[model samples]
Target: MPPAYVEALGSVAAVLTTFCWIPQAVKVIRTRETRAISLTTQVALSVGVVLWLLYGILHVSWPLIGANAVTLVLLIVILAMKLRHG
Candidate 1:
């Protein structure tokens, strides 16, 4: 495949995954509640995101870096809120 197409696909995947977190973040923020969320799941997700960020850096993947950076922020916020409220 062409570089343009590869980049486009990567960008699209990044956008979709990044946007997917918005709803969860907004819901947690608005409700200020996280009782329904599992602690194990959040921890695992945080670890996964961190690894993805590192992988992105190593690979020099802009899409991975951008997407994982935003996702990491969102996850951190949600985790904080969960700890505070739960």
Candidate 2:
């Protein structure tokens, strides 16, 4: 595969993954309640995202790093809300 194609695919994947969380974040923020959300799932996802971020950094992949970084923040916010409200 060409370098351009690889980069493009990576960008697309990153965008898709990052944007996928938008609805969840919005729902949580709007409702200001996380009672329905599972803490275990959020914790697992946060851990996974952190690992992905670390992998991206190690490989020097900007798209992965950026996307996972944003995702981690969003996840953290949701987790915090869950802990606070639940």
Candidate 3:
């Protein structure tokens, strides 16, 4: 496959994972059932997201920047919910 296709695979993966979190975030918000969610996991995810956002911005990867931004917000919401009710 061409390098372009390989790079596109990365974007596709980003989109799928980033968007997939939407449903989980929505479910968590609605049910407020976050006992199964780990505090450590959310914290680590948030940190990773922020770092990815920074890397995306520095590298001018708009797709990464946008996806990470949305993912970061979702993670923050989940983290806050977990902290509030965990």
Whichever of 1 and 3 has more lDDT, that candidate is 3
For candidate 2, the TM-score is 0.80
* Candidate 2: C-alpha RMSD after superposition: 2.3
Write the residue-wise lDDT of candidate 2 on 43-71 in tens digits: 99999999999999999988779899999
lDDT of each: 0.90, 0.89, 0.92
After TM-score superposition, the amount by which residue 61's alpha carbon in candidate 1 deviates from its true location, in angstroms, is 1.3
lDDT for model 1, please.
0.90
**Ranking of predictions according to lDDT:** 3, 1, 2
Q: Could you tell me how far off, in angstroms, the CA of residue 62 lies in candidate 3 after the best superposition?
A: 1.1
Q: Candidate 3: global Cα-lDDT?
A: 0.92
User: What's the C-alpha lDDT at position 47 in model 1?
Assistant: 94
After superposition, which runs of candidate 3 have C-alpha atoms over 4 Å from their true positions? Answer: none
Best by TM-score: 3
Candidate 3 structure quality by residue, lDDT tens digits, 3-78: 9999899889988989888888898899999999989999999999999999999999898899999999999888
Better of 1 and 3 by TM-score: 3
